[model samples]
Target: MTNDFRILLKEDMRNDETGERWFQDIEIGSVFFFSVQASTLHDSTPPALLDDVMAYEAFQVTLQIRHGVYNFGKRGAWQHLEDKPWWPLFEAESPVLTVAANLPVATVQQVYEDLVACEKAHPEMTTKKCLRSLSVC
Candidate 1:
């Protein structure tokens, strides 16, 4: 078996029917694990000392996703992102989100799918540049 693979999306969310937390990793296939804290973006992080954000939905991501990510890690204030093609690992549902970031899982899934489509179509631009250049939409 190969030692490396790409992760398209992952979710450690609560099971609606059983009220139990579940773990899901989506790559070419799915892997499962158990999590006690389902809705949390970071189980280990203390609540962020944001100026105004009361709560948010967050994810663990690769550093290449955003320009400031590596510098942010250098500050040694939080955990560093993963090192791989997953380089830009975390993405906000949007630039700014509010209230549990309470989007449906299907919607969140679609956002990642759209990101892949964007990457495929642009080939040379980062996701940010693609969306920014397409500013008409």
Candidate 2:
């Protein structure tokens, strides 16, 4: 009864000539290691506080613990006003993969902590995984 997955990070850059957004860069941010089940994808996984696609889910698995490999960096103070948003990394964009998303990206650690205390706790997860932290020691 294992059906938990990790969230990957995507980077977007706007073209200087065309001013088009692209989702050219996708990096593995943090990952929660759980046994994959066939029903994980089709079944209702944990609801995303943020708008992210569902990777896996299970009735017994509530997202709590996570292991991060790379940092998504701190949240920027960019607002969607008439002002310009601070986006520097562009030339490295894949053009084919990059796209625009102004919403603040949640850190892996933050997401983990949130799910642990989520009101809609999974039946099995609420009793186990949700109580743990990112560390093993």
Candidate 3:
């Protein structure tokens, strides 16, 4: 199975109290959501079942910039700063970022840079540690 991902929606949310948007200002607690469309192709499937073999799915990814790390909402995972390979998912030319062109590229780059700095300062934090500290685990 070959899968391709594309951004179906990109939302840069603002702070409810501060009314500050993420793209305009890189805030520590900024949040964003990306609705992705995944297309999977099954090449081994019979020609008669080609249409059924190709499947599409829509999923949402929620990310929040914490004090010194970013959190993946669904998996409750904390991503560190050194992870740059996945950044391509936000770039315009990447397969995963084909849609949502309304978002400025520079703004996305700035967010990435800000996240790197935020995570670099506190590399010890992880999803388990964070949840344990909050007594949520």
Specify the highest-TM-score model's number: 1
Winner by lDDT between candidate 3 and candidate 2 = 3
Local distance difference test, candidate 1: 0.29
Please give the lDDT score at residue 117 for candidate 1. 41
- Each prediction's total of clashing residue pairs, residues at least 3 apart in sequence or on different chains, is 8, 7, 0
Q: What's the best-to-worst order under TM-score?
A: 1, 3, 2
Give the residue spans of candidate 2 off by over 4 A. Answer: 1-14, 29-101, 105-137
For residues 1-137, what per-residue lDDT tens digits would candidate 1 score against the true structure? 22111132233454444433333533211111111122333331222322222232332222113321112233211122123233233343432111122333333334344434433443333233434544321
Residue pairs that clash (backbone atoms under 3 angstroms), model 2: 22-98, 22-99, 23-97, 23-98, 23-99, 24-97, 24-98
Off by over 4 Å in 3: 1-101, 127-137
TM-score, every prediction: 0.28, 0.16, 0.24
Which residue pairs collide, candidate 3?
A: none
Per residue, candidate 3 scores C-alpha lDDT tens digits across 1-137 of 11122221223443445322222222232222233211121111121111221232222222343432234443222343225554444434331122322223343434444544554455444454543454332
In model 2, state the lDDT of residue 99: 20
Each candidate's lDDT (Cα)? 0.29, 0.25, 0.31
* lDDT of each residue in 40-95, candidate 2, tens digit only: 22122342222333442321222212322111222111111113232231121231
